[model samples]
Target: MTSFSPGRLGLRAKFAVIAVAALLLGGVAVGYTLRSTPEPSTGPAVTSDGPERRTTGPGGPRLMVLSNGVRSSVALRDPAGPREVSSQRCERVYAAADTVACLAPAGALEGPKLLVSDRHARARESVRLTGIPNRLRVSASGRMVSWTVFVGGDSYAGSSFSTRTGILDTEGGLRLDTLEDFRITREGKPYRAADANYWGVTFAADDNRFYATLSTDGHRYLVEGDLAARTVRTLADNVECPSLSPDGDRIAFKQAVDGDPAKGWRPAVLDLATLETSRLAEHRSMDDQPVWLDDRTIAYALQRPDGVNDVWSVPADGSGAARLLVPQANSPAPVA
Candidate 1:
């Protein structure tokens, strides 16, 4: 693997980026562009670590996946801050800068409110199509939020994941589910695989299309879901829990092609322009989810096989070695 240093790139490499951006200046149709702009992953680390149940201090915001199954939020700024979610079983949680999003069990909701202000715990904001929000992602700009909600069963209905792309606006009218409602697979059966699980939803800097990792099996198979186009396609195999780049062109994910589940999931990246995946760092045991610290550096939680997990960051170009960022926390979530 080659280490890409923005400071040391040659003229030809710099020119290529400019050329790609120039062609991309005009609105190009979703799958028609000749080249994808190599975006810098300059944003908050996605799901840095799971939220700690017993949090301390005022240095950060904390989220709790409650026992009642609902995910609740508490701001450390105020020791007596109001709780965020009252009743949703928190399946997954992600924070984009200051705004945070989570997957909650539909049954945990007290009313029809789907969105809320992460700043103000009690305030109800916008609501989307009815269903249980099992996978959630917030954008870096906090202007767009998207989640996969299932409209079936009483709780975790065992339903396959469906796409719901949304844009947040100031007027606060009905949420924009899509730019234009379109279909992907024609005359197709709805995807409701028993184990068709969706995780790792992320927002690009532009907040246009969202990306997630969906899998039927953890071995040599992973599907990338395009939230805006209403399509799901194969991008990389043997990969799961992918986080998108801030500029939105490349992706950082974990792959376990060796079939060793414990040591299988290691940090990797896919350059969209070339459709090439570079494995940056691989631990003997499975590493936790990986997120881009910048276009060139990635930070992730790594555990000693079946041991504890801690946060670490390394250059994406694969030059600099992985450096420990923080000590082991049950689940760590980093704020930008």
Candidate 2:
């Protein structure tokens, strides 16, 4: 295991990054071309130990998974006077409606533990995970919670990039650790492989149906998963990190460039009914699964020129230019 710094490196250093495992937003492999343009300064300074302030926004309540190296806190999105929901150190956080799920890794070398908490960050139910949890999401109705973790390996090792994507039925007390048991079909035929790994889950409003990224035998594909039948089938190739839209008819995902996973991906949206995909105007490698700000706009985290991660938004239909939404925020959960 080697150390990874998110700063820009020369060609020699980038080649080194490919060898040693690099951590992306969802704990996926990092192999994208760096964006050289400087991001415009818009919000307040991102301080790890800053005090809470109150600022107004359009949505109901803005949720941010913030950490100051030693401690992680869930704070409201107000930059002027942010409000604290909890003082727990979480690696990732997802909030929707009245449900907030926090992914916390127990020590420096321990596995992850997930806590389903209230809006005030009170733990209502908790569960231990089999791996290091990275991505967290809640269904539109807040009845379903899904998470993805790098299973059986550490983030620093090349072999540890394999993932286990899981879903928890909060109302039913049902938990599926991995989708490997789900019946799988590739190109409309039964495809079985022991190397299949799933990650980056995005759920629909119905809660029973969802989409995710499945990797097997050196290839990645966008998969449609059904909760009731416990089955999944590949929908398309070269798709990683599928995020369904607010209307449940479209999906925003990352498309691998030039059929190469290591070359990085472009953010795009797919109309589920039409099977049509349109690339957004971000024009940079996005490592995080995007969150829908509304039906028309989507937000995602990108490493700025200052090396810290910030939230940015673009039109879902690939029409408008990208704009900075929140500064120094890694995980953006817009509560409505």
TM-scores of the candidates in the order shown: 0.52, 0.76
Cα lDDT, model 1, residue 250: 81
TM-score of 2: 0.76
Per-residue lDDT of 169-259 in model 2, one digit per residue for the tens? Answer: 9889898877889988888998899888888899877889999988887677889988899888988887888888888888898777786
Per-candidate local distance difference test: 0.50, 0.72
Best by TM-score: 2
| True-vs-predicted CA distance for residue 70, candidate 1, Å | 14
Q: Give the backbone clash total of model 1.
A: 16
Model 2 bad stretches (over 4 Å):
1-63, 67-85, 108-110, 152-160
**Residue pairs in candidate 2 whose N, alpha carbon or C atoms collide under 3 angstroms:** 52-82, 53-80, 53-81, 53-82, 54-81
- Evaluated against the true structure, the overall lDDT of model 1 is 0.50
* lDDT by residue for model 1 (223-276), tens: 544555656555555665667776677887776647444445667788877878
